[model samples]
Target: MSRFRRTWLQHSLRAALALGATFSLGLGNAQAASTTKILVGFPAGGGSDAIARILAERMQIELGSNVVVDNKPGAGGQIAAQALKAAAPDGQTLFLSHDHSITILPMVTRNPGYDSAKDFVPVAGIATFVNAFAVSGGTTAKTFQAYVAQVKQQGGGKGVVGIPAPGSVPQFLVQVIARKNGLDLVAVPYRGSAPMMSDMLGNQIPAGVASIPDFIENHKAGKVRVVAVMGTQRQASMPEVPTLAELGLSGFEEVPFYGVFAPAGTPKATLDKLALAIQKTIAQPDVRDKLTTMGLSVGFMSSDELAARERSYAKVWAKIIQESGYQPN
Candidate 1:
């Protein structure tokens, strides 16, 4: 090749490489596309997985990048939390979890494999949600009161209640309920909501306490009846259902939160950028409607706000878990 032509070709290649590098670093408008992954610590089709998928779709429109969800379901999200800790904090990986993995796990687990305080930083707080006490199809009881009465009359005040996972918030709620109602209720823990839900549908388990989303569809289909929700107020999607507080049960008035977190030391600019994308996604009417339908009180909280909220929730559960006399396994 001629010298001039070779020189021009070399310069062109250099410029293209520079542009690609900048874009790959998530810099500059009109940049090349990149992939961001949202990790869930549960199986697909679960509440957190569903929320991550929904937000990821809308977030792609806002951020103009490919977004995906990766599930690492095990040990009540321990595997996924450990994965997040080992990931590079380049803003490409995020963990979507509720207060269980971030708040309850650390308290109830001897070592959950990740340190939320040091290994992860809050990206965004999506919404607050409630746990529901639901009855299987084989049961005749409708209201929470009726369920308790039936258990007492038929089962000698001894009953079995299912929870999605052990050491979870739902289990603690069960303990509280058993004590309050004077029922000797034993909480049977499961690996995930899906199996626990299956038991509820098939009448293998008479009752369960899980996130409202876990049982909403089944409830709507008349497979299970959500007798009571845990929170200060009733869920808008199920206004007919009463809150535990309304049922004269106290200490469970506060709800749990859903949040996104990135590995520690991620750049502030990147965190802000992702947070804005999430905020925009959450602000979409369709997004809000979908999440609300699934029993989430859709709301947005900033990074700092999420940090404070998590701290406060930790304190909240700390008192509850301590009162329950739970020992980490």
Candidate 2:
């Protein structure tokens, strides 16, 4: 063979191999893009985890990709929030949580590991849930007013109320209610709703404040009685219970919300795709029913709308926390 021809053939072989390698790398990137993960700050079998799983199933259908839920429960959702903050902004990792991790934690905790406004970009708002002030069936108080009178009559020092978490919305509400009504109700924080509900069922605590869903089952069983719900209007599930507004308590009408968020700097195109998928998922009749049955008021908000809502919610909680003079532990 001629030397020139031999050299040309060798160079041609090298170019072909390089081209094949590049094509294989491209396929890997596409596969990675096809998979998505929804991160939950709580363990499985809880409300947040259930929401994540439900959305993930529907999202997989809407997105035409494999979607999953990853639980990273710790530090009142700080660990999961931090993981998302440092994650690659590829839209694959999202945080599914409620107000505790997003709006209220930052206000009460000295450092919550991630800034809701700065570290994450809002993707969509899922739904809203109402908090309730409940008492054991064994209690003598038949109404919220009666409950207050009992607390005051028993003396301020003995008034204790159980809450799900220390820096949670229910805890702050307990403090605010006690101060406003001239009752010295002490706020007792528990790790989560499960234990708090258990204590309430055993009559270990006479009164407790938590999401209505957290106590709805027991309330139905006549194990506990929900005295008042904190929303602008009554819950459809518990229509007989009056709202804080109807009881003449202003500014207690705003319900806590659940939302999805991605790490900051996630591509706009990715965010839009996620938001659309979420909107579709929430619009499903069965999905809405499931959420409603689980105590969430099924609703939807677009990306931009959710962002604005978060800002407004944060501001409201900030004022409440400041007024209560709560210092983070």
Candidate 3:
């Protein structure tokens, strides 16, 4: 070939490579710009998992990016919490967890390995709801009042009430109910609701406490009965079930809440974007209706409001922990 023709071919090759490089760089930037993930501190079928999935699906549409729900369950949410802080502070990764792992776990553990105040920034609250204490299908206690009387008769020896974990709201509720009624109810601890529900189904433990919604369908199907609802008022989903107060137990209110958080130092703009996405996803009428059907009310709060609520709840839980005589393990 002629030298001039060969030179022209080489120039053409160089131009093509330059264009490819530019396209590759642009694609990289676009991928980095578009992808976001929400991490849940529990396995699938758990409340956080459900919330993460719902938010991920909706937020993906709202934010125009692929939103993924990653479950990193272990150490009672410490694993996910630590992983969240280690992730890039670019709003690409978020943590969706409930009150126990975020507030209760740290307060009860000597070194939980993550500081909520320093390592994370609140993005938005997802939902808040109560737990219902119920007995297995085969249990003889049919009513909350009857359950109380049965516990009194057994003097807390005849039955064991299972709780997800120590220092959790459900655990405290168990302690409070047992103590207030002068019943010697023993708490059987489980890793989480999934296993606890399994035990209840198997009748390994006759009575158990779980997220209100987790047991709602079962209650509706007549597979189990709620003996007590742990809040001041009857839950909107289960109006027939009475609160602890109405059952003649005063001041037995325990409400569990969940929220979203990003790693600390994440830009306010990024967090705001995420918050807007969350609000948008949660504000839909269908979303609210579905969550309510699941026995969870729509609970969305601003960053500041969520932070303040966390602080106040921490103090209250800390006091309860001290009163319950719980020490870090």
Candidate 4:
């Protein structure tokens, strides 16, 4: 009674197991084909976009999904931030942005169209970068002090400077420097750093304020010279350059950050998973070196730590903006 029945039962069980494995394989492939997009607030050739692409390439492999970068450039990244707010809480869409969009935009704009606190949650912190003040090739000034002197000598201590965008932190920095120096300096805003760089290269603008990454390549190319930087200490990429504090311009020790964010209401588990993948990618030697070479201080911060750092950064900028008496746009 037993031999025939036992043999038949074993064969049936093996066939069922094989079918289940085949089904699971097909499901995994389908999931892998689903695309995950990282939204960048700046144009493609900018620092934020570069970082996003690098991280997306690595994250695609780590997350075992299709990861891609989507640029939404305008209004100092207001457009991209608004897109993130409108996105669903699913893990598929994320915003890869720096402090200007996440921390400072709200403070400067009356209505930036998106609220960081209410509409987004920090996923991870990628790196921190510092702002720089640079002059064009046509300018005779070799140093920021000399530039100011030239402005005083040639233009009655009045000059026009380029900024990455309106309501940007660099714009405020221009005011801070002008106020401290007792000169009339006005910041002319552009759409992004790339365009600002273009004007500087063509000598259409005498000087501009932007991130170190934005100007470092040109600084090396000799088209522009980074005369001063905003940080407590000098950068490794440009050790010869002077810090704002060294130039007797203090109180700007706060460094700007680049991080990833998911729309609010996204599950904590999903956020945590993405954060871990980012931490893994940043930990890679090649990724770290690439970002470091771009004048960034590459480091990973936890989601909660990033959120806290963002708030602290906002507070610092808030005071500076208020003291400058700059009206919100």
Tens-digit lDDT track of model 1 for 166-254: 89999999989999999999999988788788888889999999999888989999999999998888889989999898888898877
Could you tell me which 10 consecutive residues in candidate 1 have the lowest summed lDDT? 24-33
> Model 1 residue 89 lDDT?
91
| Local distance difference test, each candidate | 0.91, 0.86, 0.82, 0.92
lDDT of 4 by residue, 1-329 (tens): 59999999999999999999999999898875577889988888887888888999999889988899999999999999999999989889999989999988998889899889999999999899999999999999999899989999999989999999888889989998998888899899988898888899999999999999898888998999999999999999999999999999988899999999999999999998899899999999999998998899998999988999998999989998898887888
Model 3 spans > 4 angstroms off: 1-29, 151-156
Superior by TM-score: candidate 3 or candidate 4 = 4
The best candidate by lDDT is: 4
Off by over 4 Å in 4: 1-33
On TM-score, the stronger of 2 and 4 is 4
Give me candidate 1's TM-score against the actual structure: 0.90
Off by over 4 Å in 1: 1-33
Clashes per candidate, residues 3 or more apart or on different chains: 0, 0, 1, 0
Model 3: per-residue Cα lDDT over 149-259, one tens digit each: 876676544458988776677777788877777677778877767677778778788888878866877778777788778778888777888888886666545466889
What is the alpha-carbon lDDT of model 2 when measured against the actual structure? 0.86
User: lDDT (0-100) at residue 202 of candidate 1?
Assistant: 87
